[model samples]
Target: MIGLILAIILFNFIAFKTNRRHTQNSILHIWLFTIAFQLIFDTMIEFKYHGYWYFDKEVDWLGLLAHTLLIPPVNMIFLNWYPLQGRLRSRILYTLIWVAAIMGYELLTLLPEPWGYFHYGWWNLWYAAILDPFLFYILIKFYRWIRSLEERI
Candidate 1:
């Protein structure tokens, strides 16, 4: 609980405060897209499949806090820092670094009780590792598409 709360505060602060690149509209779009995407993915994996869940195996309202507050800002921060103009190799490397950080954080969230909010049933870090790059790719593509739309508008 404490861990998740602190992380939410810190991540939101960093994401919003340090954002010099995206406009308010863009940020709003990104936030909405992230929440919707996460909810869809979690609904399938956490609920339908019972792969993993937040706080407990059963559905809980507290888990919504983790879903709504924690990850979108992290995604914001990620897109904010992404090297859009950099070489392909640099971009790939940057993504891998973020994946490692995410995996590390996921590990921390597997800790007991008050500190931990995440749990696994059949899912594991390896699954996340495989999925994250594709996820990041999707985010990048979405951001680019949004940017293109913004340019036309």
Candidate 2:
């Protein structure tokens, strides 16, 4: 719980410091929408089907809180640093880097119960490593689409 709160605070602080452009509000909104969908999907998969579990069976709310707290700022930071003008190679590399980071984080969460925030039931690391890059790709594409749509308006 302490770790979760600290992470939220750190994420928010970084976002606050770096995400200053008024123009980015739209990007932030898009990120929020994407992360919200992720949370809902995760809830169904992790809770309903028991794909994974958090902490113990007792304080499951922290799992929800963790997802809600972490994702938006992560998306924001990813976009903030992403090279909007860069070539396909640079862009793909950037995406891969973030994907690696996410996979590493997931691996950390897979540690033993008291230290680790999460434990896999049916889920495993390889699935996360493979899917995370695709997920980030979807988010980047979605954000770009939203930008283009707003431009047309």
| Location of the lowest summed lDDT over 10 successive residues in candidate 2 | 20-29
Provide the TM-score for each candidate, comma-separated: 0.97, 0.83
Residues 47-66, candidate 2, lDDT per residue (tens digit)?
A: 67777767754436677777
The alpha-carbon lDDT assigned to residue 133 of candidate 2 equals 81
TM-score, candidate number 1? 0.97
Q: Tens digit of lDDT per residue, candidate 1, span 56-120?
A: 87789999998888998999999999999999999999999999999999999998878888999
lDDT of each: 0.93, 0.74
Off by more than 4 A, model 2: 20-24, 57-59, 112-115
lDDT of predicted model 2: 0.74
The RMSD of every model to the true structure, in order and in angstroms, is 0.8, 2.4
